[model samples]
Target chain A: MEILVAAILTIITAATPLLFAALGELVTEKSGVLNLGVEGMMVMGAIVGFAAVHYSGSATVAIFASMLAGASMAAIFGVLVLVFHASQVPTGLALTIFGIGLSALVGQSMIGVAYDGIPQLHIPVISDIPVIGEIFFSQDGLVYLSIFMVFAVMWFMNKTRAGLILRAVGDSHDAAHAMGYSVLKIRFLAVLFGGAMAGVGGAYLSLAYSPLWVEQMTAGRGWIALALVVFASWKVRRVLLGAYLFGGISILQLHAQALGIAVPSQVMSMLPYLATILVLVIISRDRSKIKLNAPASLGKPFHASR
Target chain B: MLPRLIKRQSPSKAMVYLSPILALLLTLLASIVLFLIMGVSPSGALHAFFVEPISSIYGLTELMVKATPLILIGVALSLGFRAGVWNIGAEGQLILGGLFGGATALFFYEKTGFYIIPLILIMGALGGIIWAGIVAFLKTRFNANEILTSLMLSYVAALLLNLLIHGPLKDPDGFNFPESRLFSDSALLPILYDGTRLHLGAVIALFFVGIGWILLSRTLLGYQIKVMGDAPAAGEHAGFSHSKIIWTTLLISGGAAGLAGAIEVSGPIGQLLPNISPGYGFAAIIVAYVGRLHPLGVLFAALLLALSYLGGETAQMKLNLPVAVTGVFQGLLLFFLLACDVLIQYKIRTSKKSESTIAPAVKSSIKSTSEVK
Candidate 1:
């Protein structure tokens, strides 16, 4: 019972960052831009958020500052790929490298500093329940926000007019331009949202998950989040499921080590990445199914020559 | 006000020469800004970054040592990229090559014969070729995106290395550190000079660069690669098999990357450890591009990038600067290069509603109509 409870709790915590990141990436990809700089952005968020809380002694400010920083970085990427018409792949890679370097350079001083993170909030009746309450209703505010954001993104992408325009732009930028929609404007907004969400995810690491800043604290979570987007098939709800599943795998590796499992840690560490690759290969095997839902102008630069 | 229009042009001879130099100048400017933000004097930091590394013998040796793998990998990456094949998994290939070659060397530790080193080198190159062959096969057979697949496979390769070093390949007598047994003197790469850590790998790297240059400029295969990259349909019409090119490019590149990895373990490191690579595979991608994906250009670019790695360490110890500054410079250089490349392809033209615009506009409209048809 205790192990099950612990696993469930671990899943939620692990899922939070991935959820935030994948949701952000979904928005970016939906706008026909693939930003591969999530890892870099997340690291910057981790450092800035840690610095904010460490200096100001406030979690709110740290989280807010992280989002701003992330959004700003994303904006630079948006300008390069959207306005300057740079190749999306190389630009995205450059953004990531820039982010990683900037974060490491800035984060050197804040090593070992701990922040007082946001505390858990529990509902009255739900808090009193046994296992269900402990698992579901007792997470910190950010975890709840991540779950809410997932549903919010689903609704925003499906039921809203802005969502429709965003989808139309992603499906076919030329058609969207022909229909008098501002493809660049919609893409800019989507990219900004993605950047901000990625920032929040980074903040979750420093402000809540680890409560400390470490160089490359996001590790390869950004890459995992990128993989999760493909695994989710670009659906909002499925992103949540994929994130939690990846989170579970990550946590399982940690717990296995703690329990003195005989399996090599390196092999175990490869589980999440290997699983993601396997999922990609399987999904990509039948190209037609993927083509059905894939964004038509995904990763291609759109230039209006009117 | 009228929006400025730009006329696209074929790349000129002068611009081709100027692009990299301009990119470097922009990178330096960006680095100065970065140094200012980090509270270091720009000139002093730049000196520490570039000049100081080549000043002392120790630093020079370190630069050469670092450049060995970079030169090898950069050459390999240039070959594939010139043919328009993006092999982003060189890091993984490098790791696998190191593991295989290192294992072979260790296995033959007792048999200190004349042929041991040669055998290990061959095995290392073979290891890299096999690893790259996986991506090549998938790409040719299923039309899978090599960029994503190659990159993802690198993670698998890394994990396999980690598993080996920590588990089965762990040095038996050593304390709990995750590393393989140190290679014997017979297994190790011989030093080139009397005092420095620089070894035969440097010579090997130069030899490969020469070979790469010859193959790219003079061979029929090289022409096929260029044509394939420039116009895939035209190459197909010219009777070049896309699958064959894919296999050839990946195998050659992968073998080069693998050879570098093997040399790395045998040379400076002398042992297999958990974190063997400092992202040499990925960094070589930048070096390849900065070199314009040309074999000889890759040599110079590799040295410049190698200097950054050496300088990054110097800054870390002397100025208390973060090592990530190296990565920042690399990223900045790539960004500036892309910007410069745009200028190379397109000439900015400003007009005030004049006669010149009418002719170009009419031509563009005609081209657009034909393109639509």
Candidate 2:
């Protein structure tokens, strides 16, 4: 019973960063721009956030600083792809490579620094409940915020006028232009939001999860978040489910190792990644179904020549 | 209103060649700015970045050594890019190929047979082909986006490689450092030069480049690939199957990437370490694009990129620069190249009234909500 509760808790903790990143990417893609630099942005966030916390000795400031760092990086991407009419695929990838390199260079001195992590906030009354309370209400504030952000994102996308405009820009920039929409501005905002969220996700890793800075510390969680965006089929609610599923797979590998399972620890570590690919394969099997939900102009660059 | 710049019917052929050079120069200028920001002299940094790495015999050999896998992967990627089939998972395929080829060599480590090395090479290529075939299969069967699928599969492959090295393939005699057993004498790639680390892999890369050039230019398959990439509808109208092209391109590229991975393990590293490739698969993407998906062009780009890798190490030792400079340069080069490529396809005209008209169109696309449906 304790193991079950622990597993659920592990899943939530593991999913938090991915949740933040995928949700951010989801919004970005929903606006019709595929920002492949999420991984790079996340790493930059992790490093910058860690550096901020290390220098200032404040976790709140670090998280906010990370958001700003991530947004700025996204803004650069926006300038390249949205304004300059650069190819989306390569530009996003270059942003990632650039981000990773910049982060690594900046993070060289911060290899072993430790930061005071954000504390878990347990809800009153619910804290005393058996397994459910421990699983749901006992995580750090970021975990709850990630969950709340999903609902918030879903509502914003479905209900808000701004969300509607963003979606319109993504669907067909030409038509949106005809209707007096600013595709570049909407994409810029989406990219910034995505980058900020990715940064927050990165902060969760350094400030909360490991509570220590390491070079390339986020590992491949950024890639996993990118995969989650695809697995979610570009929906806010599905991103939450996908993040949790991947998180569960990640935790399961550790649990399996602890259980003295015959599988190698290295192989176990690959579970989440392999599961992501498998999920992508399964989800992508029905092409027609996925095409309906995908942003039509997701990877196409908007060039206004008229 | 400003006078409109005359729109050329087509870009001059000389400009096509000049663009990449201009892009390279722009990249150097941008990197100099980066160095200045880092408080390093731009000229000294450029010297450290490009010249210092290839000045000595040892540095030149090291550059060649690093260039081997990159050349192979770049050539493979060029083939696919030319066909419009983006096999971004070459890194994964390479790892899997290394695992297979390395395992083969390890399996026969005690044998002093003549065929051991040859068998490893074949198995390495085969391993890559099979790995690539997975992506090809998915694309054909499900109409999956090859870019995301292949790229995602790479992480899984890397993890699987890590698992194998730390578990079943763990070096038995060594302390518990997650690595595979060293290849026996027969399994090791014979060094070409006595004093240098340069091996048969470099020769193999050049050979493949030549072969790729021929295949891309002289073969019917090459024409089909080019047609499919440039005009997919026309290719279909001409009775060419997109599925066939995708499979062919991915398999060929995957096989090449796998071969490079195998060669790295067997020839140079001699063992399967957890992170054997410092993102060679990913780096090859830059090499492929920077080379403009041409075989001979990829050869030069590969050598240049390899210099960056070598320069990164030299910079690390001499100037206290981080190794990330190589990545930064590669990314910057690609960014500049892509920026240059935009000029190849579209001519930029700056007219006053036209510029204002463009801004509103660009702006309006961000405002309209009714167009989403």
Sum up the clashes in candidate 2.
16
lDDT of 1 by residue, B155-245 (tens): 8898898888877789998797888889998988999987889899999999999999898889999899999988999999999988898
Interface RMSD of 1: 1.8
After superposing candidate 2 on the true structure, give the runs of residues whose Cα lies further than 4 Å from its correct spot. A122-133, A258-260, B1-15, B352-373
Q: What tens digits encode model 2's per-residue C-alpha lDDT throughout A36-139? A: 88888998899999899889887788889999989988888887787656778778888888888888888888987766688787779897698877776777
- The CAPRI class of candidate 2 is medium
List the candidate 1 regions with Cα displacement exceeding 4 Å. Answer: A257-261, B1-7, B138-144, B350-373
Q: Count the backbone clashes (under 3 Å) in each candidate.
A: 0, 16
Provide interface RMSD per model, one decimal: 1.8, 1.8
Q: Each predicted complex: what DockQ?
A: 0.53, 0.65
List fnat per candidate, in order.
Answer: 0.53, 0.64
Candidate 2 local Cα displacement, residue A173, angstroms: 1.6
Give the alpha-carbon lDDT of every model: 0.85, 0.85
TM-score of each: 0.92, 0.92
